[model samples]
Target chain A: MYKVKVYVTLKESVIDPAGAAATKEFKNSDYPEVEQVRVGKYIELTIGDTSKNVEEAVHDMCKNLLVNTEVEDYRFEIEEAAAK
Target chain B: MYKVKVYVTLKESVIDPAGAAATKEFKNSDYPEVEQVRVGKYIELTIGDTSKNVEEAVHDMCKNLLVNTEVEDYRFEIEEAAAK
Candidate 1:
């Protein structure tokens, strides 16, 4: 089995209103030093097979559905799991 | 200034109901091979100062407000940005 990790985040130039709101809330709660906040999403998947075909399929899923490539940028890494 | 990256995730033993729902939805959209999805949160903060006091304040904010230490696990890294 292999573990896949994906990180999805807004394009660097895009404004993140939600992130700003969270930052505002945090600052108001006595932590006034927080300068800025940018929020993103993380996803993990465990694939049962380690075949090349499976890896290609997973990549296709990430490209077409798992991430909105137009508005978001995503990066993924696949790693071998320790023997269980 | 320094950049702080924080990753917050549900404990390994906890059930991720939202992640499961997202996986189900993705599978229903013709991507049947997607086995599972575990969702987490990522936060990035840009602190205006790199002083030890500033770093300590950022750590405290992360511990008390940025992440729910009870149900979530978080890790952070600080990096110096390329001079612009």
Candidate 2:
């Protein structure tokens, strides 16, 4: 099996309210040592052994649904899954 | 600077509605190649150089806010940030 890890994050030009709130919350919670905080979506996909072009399939997945291209950017890492 | 990458995922026993929906959507979207999908949160934290124990501080942050121990599990990878 193949394991694909996808990270969907807001574009640098976009404002992230959730991230800003978390930063403020950390500062107020006595974690004044923090410099920055960013929050995003992490998705893991388990792909069954197949002959299909996995890379193209995943790229389409991200572009079509997993990510909002208008405001978010996404990247993925692929690896073989260890034997169960 | 220290860069911390945190992944917060639902416990195995917990049912993930968002994941289920995504799985169904994939199946219908001509991507029968998909097997399974799990969704979670990805967080990045930047910490300034300090005398405090970095690992301990991050652990506290995860336990106090980044994770919901009742339903989610979290793990972190820390590394030195690249010079900007």
Which prediction has the highest DockQ against the true structure? Answer: 2
Per-residue lDDT of candidate 1, residues A33-80 (tens digit): 567789998888776554457567667777887777777888888887
Per-residue lDDT of A16-84 in model 2, one digit per residue for the tens?
Answer: 888889989988886877877889999988887778788888899899979999999999999988745
What does the i-RMS of model 1 come to? 2.0
Q: Tens-digit lDDT track for model 1 on B1-84? A: 667888888988888998889788866865554567899987887766544575677678778777777778888888866534
Each model's TM-score? Answer: 0.83, 0.93
For candidate 1, the lDDT comes to 0.77
Q: What's the lDDT for all of these models?
A: 0.77, 0.88
| DockQ for candidate 1, C-alpha atoms | 0.64
